[model samples]
Target: MEHVGVEQFPPDKTGDAMTTALLHLENHYWTESEYLAIGETPERIELFDGSLVVTPTPTVGHQYIVSRLVVSLYEVARSAGLHAFAGLGIRLGPGHIRIPDFLITTELNFDDRVNDSDVVKLICEVISPSNASTDTVQKMRHYADAGIPWYLLIDPRSETFHLFRLDGDRYTEHAKAAPGELLELTEPVVATIDPAELLPPR
Candidate 1:
């Protein structure tokens, strides 16, 4: 993937190249390969149903929760013979690629950059304010459509956790927890995390 000879655009600032690309790419119908060729942009870029979607850079609170989850879940997954990764692009289907905040798989195969759906056991996302709808709605639909067995959403603003188990073409709510509650996940991944521990220190 080439750099396209442009500085990565920050969430608050769009470089001329990015602006030009976004303008031209609108309704252009991009493929997952072309989207991956753009490399790492400051903003989160995803492909869904042949269109490109740019999401805002995650806030500190969002990253904080992701970090905490990694630390908390790694041991549990490892003890149970599973592997975990953060910010890994997953190829869901033709022209569909999603980068979960983190993912848990039965094994660690770092030989490939993008993982196929089969290896993914669980996909987790730390909801940012800028991406609430996309995370809660679009991503939920996409994950279920890809036949992912499990999906977890952690919303920092509300300090809540949501777990969804895939049932046929849709996901049924499996578990949920509010702040200060212990959220125990038994399938896909096994662990109990205190939702409050993921919150940033004031």
Candidate 2:
């Protein structure tokens, strides 16, 4: 996911973390507007089916993989006259908001508050340890429901990557690879990624 910079959370100041935890425990349902009004939160949060889902802060490993993938994908998208952004909030439908790890877009509006999935050619998510199911299963369904043409999932712990394409109302797996394998994709965007490079330093 995209971040301004690494935020150092000192142990003494745990208010934000505690509040986020409490909110999760309450299982509150939030509207898309409400979630958007909350700006610059201490926690990584998203709105799924009108429910607020809080995710743990990404680890260094996750950042490393996302950075490399973004760079690689950006090169391809830029050459194709498209823009690639990290951590942009996407509106999949009413009450459905997603912050994809990376998104390739054709729109140039910098002030766009919420980008509709129609212009999004590709969406990617680097699975975090705490929210594996959200990314792997829940988000996969959401993106499909939004009619996104392409979706990619990278798992740091498993050292695996998956690419999916929208088929009607569902997604069909197009390609998958483990570390040391090359995954080539075409259609919405064209690029090759070596899953091995996505692995964090040992």
Candidate 3:
């Protein structure tokens, strides 16, 4: 993924100084140490080589789905002696990192800046209109390359959910649920998910 420019701000506003600094930082090559040094930020930032992929703050609707999934997955994960996390940074390579909306892992080590990809058992991404391809295409390829066992994609717009299992360097659709249906899974952990419960009360 390439670095799309930073969020723009008006020249006459108080944000001008911060905007100028961010623009200047963009020109420099980013290293893992430098990226880690910046620490937690308001916006979700992923590192790809020397570039940064900045995702804007998620909408309330987007977060609602994530929260619902996390709660549901956490129960299953606990039973299997695993852990579930949301917005956790995962290190794919030396200077490559990606943060899935939600994830299930074998362990939780907060000492590390980001968890290693190998520890991640499953990942979930709730699709947003602005970055649908980033979640569906780019992330799918990268996560599979990293050997993540399972991936779950939830698209609120389409009211659907897709479950995939890594199949030798690629992902093969394992199962899916359409609007108002239940998605059942048996591998990596056994659990059933309802697409309707992911949305806000109507």
Candidate 4:
């Protein structure tokens, strides 16, 4: 199937390109090939089965938290010969893709823009208001279904963090921390995290 690239639809400052992309995508079942064809978009787009989940650009605060978390994770991951990345696509299945806010993986190279779920060791998502349930509920199920061993959820609004470890086919809460507490972990790379450090200073 021939898929159109983003260059075919010029974007204006008002987001006409995204609108054009969505209009063209409506009523169509997307495959990985077709989804990848629309590369380098300004918006974050994930595919579930044949559906497209379009997420608006993240706020500056969200990016700030993600950046800080990635740096912290990277220190431990690199020491253990693993790589930590932010906003990288992971292919959970044939038509399933998700871009976690941060990921730690054994795969050292990512020239293809997407990697298989098997290469992933842990997936972390910092909650955003617009997709709270999607992050806390839907993605929890999806990551478990993909056999991702560890899932970490950080909620900046709540100033909390929850870490889950896969047991059998589902994830069980392994550790969590609230404000003024520390979230420490041993497996999947050891690290101690203070939720307060993730937020911007006053």
- For 1-202, candidate 1 gives per-residue lDDT tens digits of 1122222454545533232234332336566656765665676666677676666677888888888889988888888888877888788888777789988887656776577877888999988876688789988998888888999898877878998899999988888998767888887666887888877886
The lowest-lDDT stretch of 10 consecutive residues in candidate 4 is 1-10
- 124 in model 2: Cα distance from truth in Å? 1.3
TM value for model 3: 0.87
- Residue 158's lDDT in candidate 3: 80
TM-score of each: 0.82, 0.81, 0.87, 0.87
- For all candidates, what are the clash counts? 0, 0, 0, 0
lDDT (Cα, tens digit) per residue for candidate 3, span 67-102 = 988898888899999998999999987899988999
Q: Which stretches of candidate 4 lie over 4 Å from their true place?
A: 1-20
The lDDT of each candidate is 0.77, 0.76, 0.83, 0.83
Q: Compose the digit string of candidate 2's lDDT tens values, residues 149-198.
A: 98988877778899888899988888999977899988666788888876
Q: Report model 4's TM-score to 2 decimal places.
A: 0.87
RMSD of each: 6.2, 6.9, 5.4, 5.2
